[model samples]
Target: MCGRLALYSDFPSLACSLKLPLIKGELTPRYNVAPGTWISAVRRHDGSGQLSLDTLWWSYRPPWADDKAPQPINATVEKVATSPYFRGAFAHHRCLVPADGWYEWLAVGGRKQPHYLTRRDGEPLWFAGIWTERPDGKPGCAILTEPARGVAKAIHPRMPLILDQQSLEPWLDPELTDRETIRHLVHHLPHHELTHWPVSTRVNKPEEDDPALIEPLEPSAP
Candidate 1:
């Protein structure tokens, strides 16, 4: 469900991938990013029609909703386009979330084993996302998710809706709201490009944010 992720790539590479203009500020590498926090995303501005990189609270509640509304971290693909709570943002406020990879858990010996899933080529992944202005007036987002595919299927039943590099601009284009057209233009990255490995369960703790969390857990000799 993309509940947890990591973004440790340097800004230069991120800028190159998003074709983003210069943005001033330091971006500290975060290896264990959880929901209910500010995270980086790229989207087109409402007035300027320009692409921008900025931080968004990683949870969503439509501006019209009350403080009691649900703040969801992930929106299922099957319903996001039609759900009243998400359609507006899906159509007009789509965004791209640059991430190094995401964490998913698998059941093993009655315990949950965390696994890291990333592109085989080491390039960053751009997650399909949508945002809305919260009741408090802060910008918030929810990563889109679809049924798991390829090797990722072995780890979890679902995974983030990662976009193909070529589809990034189209996904962010506010004008492309037609469901069929969007389905035609936006395609998920090839599932085969993804690889997964067992990683330290230390990631379960939100406070644990370091490179070691992604280091592959060595397999025991059979």
Candidate 2:
């Protein structure tokens, strides 16, 4: 489950990486982005093929849902196509949730040990996501998560689905509906291109959004 993530890069830097036109709205760098806050994402229109960077509320509310149930923040690709709450967006409003890194907690000796995962080169990472806007103007999104691989399995059972440049066009293209293509893209990030390390427990708090939360923790030598 990806409950928290980091986005320390400036908007211009993100725009450069995504190769999108200049953003028209104000943006900010988010180090510890939590659910329910406004976060940046690049989404495309199914019919017009228009892509734009927009701010999406970090929680998902189904069109048929009332105000009581918990807003879903993570959507499983395996079940999204059949789920009542996610089927529409799954087929139509796919998006990319950009992040510099993400945090996951490892259960060690009954205690949660925080870990920060990112590209080894320290560049931005993109998580597959879906979004929707209601008639009243409120919009929300859910990050897609799949089974963990390699070292990530040591941290959690699931990790956000990441896409590289080679797969980005297929992932974002509305014309592409082949599930096999999507699965191939979600296989795993190459080990050499990714890295992870332990971090402080301060990241567990949603209010603790700052640079210090990502400082590496010294691991005891074996």
Candidate 3:
């Protein structure tokens, strides 16, 4: 469900990779980003029609929901267009969540083995997301997820809806509100597009943020 992510790419490199304008500020590298933390997102300005990079809280809370209401971290792709909690944002507030990679856990022989998944080509990955205004005037977003396929299926039944460069424009185009068209863009990448390997269990802790957490675990150590 994309509960954790890592973004270590520098702003300039990310800007070049995503082909979006960079905002003025220090873009800190985060190796263990968790739900509720601010995340890097790319969205089209409603008036300018230009893409801009911004930071948004990683959980989504509908406008009508109370401050105490549960904020969803992931929105199921199949229900995004029909679910009352996410439909409005799905139709009008689509965004791109840039990440170096994401973490998933697999239950293996009574133990949970954490795996780090990233693009095989080493390019930044962009996950599809929807955003909405918070009561306090800030923006919050939730990543869209679909039933897992290929290598991801070995870890869990769901994974973030990672989008390719070609799908970015249509997915974030605010004018294109047709549910079917949006749904059609929700697809899995080729099985070989992503690669995963067991990583240090240190990533299990949100506070433990460092590059070493993503390094592959020694096969004989466990």
Candidate 4:
């Protein structure tokens, strides 16, 4: 599950890569974005097929749910289309969540060590997501997760459904609502496309938001 993420890329570069228009306001760098925080998402605007970037609360609350209802941060791709809490949005409100990378904790010995995972090429990562309006009429999104594969399996049993540029358009196209087709489109990034390394434990704290958190953890004193 993608509970924490980092987005430090400038708007111009991110926009260019995502095929989005240059954002008007300053895009603040987020090194330790946590669940429930507002995060950027790309989706097709209603009526028009043009893709636009918008901020969506990281946790997802279904429209029928009360304000006090528990919002989930991640939804399994396999069940998203069938789960009563997510099916409606899954068929109609797909989105792309942009991130520089995400953090996953590895259980080593008796302690958990945090690691940062990003593309080998250093390009931005886009996670598949689904959004819906809440009872208060605000938009919220949940990242889709799949069974962990390859290296990610060593850290956790699940990982975000990271998308390649080729899959973005079809995944976000509201017109293609066929459940079978959508299911087929959902896939994890190939192990070769990703790289991960242990990072400073500072990232374990949501308050520690800086580039240093992504730096490799120093060797222990001998």
The best candidate by TM-score is 1
Question: lDDT: which candidate is best?
Answer: 1
The clash number for model 3 is 0
Question: What is the Cα-based lDDT of residue 29 in candidate 4?
Answer: 89
The TM-scores of all predictions, comma-separated, are 0.95, 0.87, 0.93, 0.92
Worst-scoring 10-residue span by lDDT in model 1:
18-27
TM-score of the candidate numbered 3? 0.93
Local accuracy of candidate 2 as per-residue lDDT tens digits, 1-222: 888999888777777777655444556777789998888888885566778778899999866677785688999867876787887887677888889999998888888888999898888888989888743467889998888877788888998888776666666767665566666654435556778888888787888888888778866621
* lDDT-sorted candidate list, best first: 1, 3, 4, 2
Error of 3 at 157 (Å): 0.8
Better of 2 and 3 by TM-score: 3
**Superposition error at 90 for model 3 (Å):** 0.7
Tens-digit lDDT string for candidate 4 (1-222):
889999898777678777644333346888999997889888776787677778888889988898678899999987998999999988899998889999999988888899998888988898999999877677999999998877888888988999877787788878788899976775556877888888988887888898888877879711
Name the regions of candidate 3 deviating beyond 4 angstroms.
Answer: 20-25, 185-188, 220-222
Q: Which stretches of candidate 1 lie over 4 Å from their true place?
A: 20-26, 219-222
Which stretches of model 2 miss by more than 4 angstroms? 20-24, 45-48, 134-136, 177-188, 219-222
Lowest summed lDDT over 10 consecutive residues: which window, candidate 3? Answer: 18-27
What C-alpha lDDT values do all the predictions have?
0.91, 0.79, 0.86, 0.84
lDDT of 4 at 147: 88
Local distance difference test, candidate 3: 0.86
lDDT of 3 by residue, 1-222 (tens): 889999998878778876656454457899999998899898876888777788999889987898798788999988999999889998889998889999999998899989999988989898999999977677999999988878888988999998877787788788889899876764545667998999988898899999998898897655
